[model samples]
Target: MTILSDIPRLLPEGMALGPALDRALAILERAGFSAVIYDYTPVPRSHDGSLITPNILEARRVPEDMLALWKSGFYQLDPVQDAALATAAPFVWSGLGKQSRVMDEVIRERHRPVLGYMHDMRFSFGVTVPIHQPRGDLATFTAIRIDAEPDFAADAAEIVPQIGVLGQIFHDVVSAGFDAETRRTHHVRLTPRERECLSLCADGLTAKEIARRIERSVPTVTLHLNAASRKLGARNRFQAVARAAHYRLIEAAPAA
Candidate 1:
C-alpha cells in the first residue's frame, strides 16, 4: 500500500494544480485505487445571487464520455454528490442509505438515465471524502476501484480515512494555487469580534443590545458588524448575519 508519509512532497514549490493533482492521484493509484476525482464548490456568497458552478478540480482515469455527461448536468442526479453536499464526512458510495421512500423512488425512476449511464461506465464502487469549508464551500474527493476485487469493500473501509486526509491535503494545495481573486472568493475569515456580533445578530438582538451584552460601546459593535458584513459580502446587518450563519462562522440560531 502506498503510505503518503510526506504529502507535502507531492507539491513542490511552483507546481501547478494539474501536476500536483496528478502526483496525488499517483499516490492513490499506488494504494490500489484505479481512479480518482476531486470536486470543489466555491463559497456561494461570491456568486452574487447567480448560479454557483462546481469545479472539477482534478480527475484521473475518468472516461471522456463520462466527464462530458457529468458536465452536461448528470451530476445533479448523482446520489454521491447529494450526499457530499449534505454531509462533511468520508463515506463509501455503497454505504449511503436512501433519504426516504420518496427520494428512493425518485432516484430509481426519475434518475434512471443517469443511473444507467453510471452503471455502463463500470464505476460501481468507490469511497468519497467530503470536505466542508467554514465558508460554505463543499468539496469531495473520490477514489474508485472499477474492477472490484473480493476485498474491495474491505480495503475501502480501511483506507477511506486516509483518502479523507488526502482530500484535505489536496484541497489545501489546490487552494494555495488559486489566484488572489479566486482565493478571496472561496475563503473568508472573520475576526472573533465580528463572529460574536454576527452570533448576537442571529439571536435577533439589536446593535445596542449586542453592545451591552458584549460590554463594548455601540459604535465599536457597529464597526465590527460593518466589517463582518463587508468580509461576508453582505449588503446589511441582516444579510451579514445570514451569510455568517451559512458559512458556519456563527450559529444560525441562539441557544435556548
Candidate 2:
C-alpha cells in the first residue's frame, strides 16, 4: 500500500515537466480528487502589487470552456487562488454549506460566466496546498471533488495536512524542467555584495553598520541594497531584506 506521503517517491523519474505535472495530477487523482489545478509563478507579485502571469499553469478535469476563460485572465480573479496566496498552509473550502472562505471578495460581474460554469460543472468542494518555494516562487496544488457532499471538507481533514508534502515534492519535480541558471537568475539574482548587504540588513544591521563591517562607504552599501531591492522587485530596502530571507538568500536573524 502506498502512503499519501510517498507520492513524491512514487513520481516517475526523469520525465519532462508536462509529463511530470500530469503524473502529479494522476497521483492526486489516486488520492481521491476528481480534478486538480496546478499553478506556478516564478514571480508571483509585482512591486505595484498586482498578479503577474504564471510561468506554468496546468489543470486536469476542468471543463475546456471555463479553462479557456480562466486562461484569458480570469485566473487572476480566482478567490481560491487568492486564498492560497494569502497563506502557506493547506486548506479546504466548499461552494456550499457555511461558506468556509471569502468567495465573493474578488467576484465581479465579468467573472459570472466562469462562476456559472463551475456551478454547472459542480467543481465545488476543494482542498488546496500552497507551496512556497525557497527561491520565492509560489505554486498551488488544488484538488477538487466534483459533486461532493457538504461533508467532503470534514472527510478531507484527515488527509489534507499530509497532502501538503505531496505539493512540496511535486513542485520540485516541475521546477526541475527549467535550466538551472535560468531558475537561479530569472527568479531572483543577487551579487555577493548585494546578498551580503541584504543578509546584514536582515540580521538587524543598519546601512552604516553594513558599510563598516564590509569596509565600504555608506553610499556604496546603500547602492548595493538599492540594487538588490530593485532586482528583488521590492519597494524598499526593508522589504528587500524580508524578500531575501523568504527566498533563503539570507538566513533568519537569530532571535534576540
Candidate 3:
C-alpha cells in the first residue's frame, strides 16, 4: 500500500498546471480521498474593497453547482473559507469545533436556501490545508472523502505535514505562469514611513495609537497611510495594509 509519506515523490515535474494537478490528485485519491480542490487568492480583496472569491486553480470530482455558487458570492458564507483565513495550519472540517457550530447555525438561520448543499453534494468529510505566503496571501488545498470510515480523521492527521508541503508546491507551480503584468502590478514599492504605518496597522494599532507609538502626529500617520494606499492602488486602509503585506513592504507581525 502506498502510504502518505510517498506522496511527495509522486508529484510530476515540468508538466502543465492541469496535468501536474491531475497527478497530485491521483495520489490523494489513492490515499482514500474521493476528490480534491485547490483554490488560490492572489489578491484577497477586489478593486472595490470587498474580499475576493478564491479562484479555483484545479479540482477533481467537485460539483459544478458548488463552483458556480462559490463564484456567485456564496463563498462569503462558506465556513471552510472562514476557517482557512483564521489559521495557518491544516485542519479537518469535521473536527473544526467552533467553525462546525457556526456553519450549522449559518445553515439553519442565515443561509437556509443552501441548507442541504453539503449533504446533497456528498461532502461530509474533508481536510483543508491553508498555505501561508510570506506576503500574507492565503491559498487553500482541500481533499474530500465522502462516506469515510470512522478512523479516517485520525489516519489523515498523520499526513497533514505532507499535505501542506504538496499544497505549497502546487501553489508555486501554478503561480509561476502568472502574466508579467500581473506580477508587476503586485510588486509596488513603499517608502519607509509608509511601510512603518502599514506595519503598525497590521499589529492592530489604531491611527492615534500608531501616531503615539511612532512619535508622529495623528494627521502625519494618516497622511502616510493615504499615500501607501494610493501607491498600492488600494481602495481603503484595510486593503492598503493587505497589499503592503503582500509586497513585503511591511511585515505582518504583531507589535512586541
- In the range 57-93, model 2's lDDT, one tens digit per residue, is 7887777776676667777666667667777788776
Candidates 1 and 3: which is better by TM-score?
A: 1
Q: Rank by lDDT, descending?
A: 2, 1, 3
Model 3 score (lDDT): 0.69
lDDT of 1 by residue, 1-256 (tens): 5446777777565567788778877888777778888777665323254223465446888877766666666666576666566567787753222232223433445466665665676665677888887766777788877766666667666777788888888787777666634533334679878888889888889999999999999999999999999997889988888777665577656367
**Residue 171 C-alpha lDDT in model 1:** 80
Against the reference, the lDDT scores of all candidates come to 0.70, 0.71, 0.69
Clashing pairs in 2: none
TM-score of every candidate: 0.62, 0.63, 0.61
Best-fitting candidate, scored by lDDT: 2
Candidate 3 lDDT over 1-256, as tens digits, reads 3344554465544456687678778878767888888777655554444446764546788877777787777666566666677677777665222234433433334443343566566565777888877755667888887767777767866776777777777767766765634332233657778988999898889999999999999999999999999998989999888777655567767445
Off by over 4 Å in 3: 1-9, 45-50, 95-115, 181-256
Model 3 Cα shift for residue 226 (angstroms): 15
Off by over 4 Å in 1: 44-52, 94-109, 180-256
Question: After aligning candidate 1 to the native by TM-score, how far in Å is the CA of 214 from where it should be?
Answer: 34
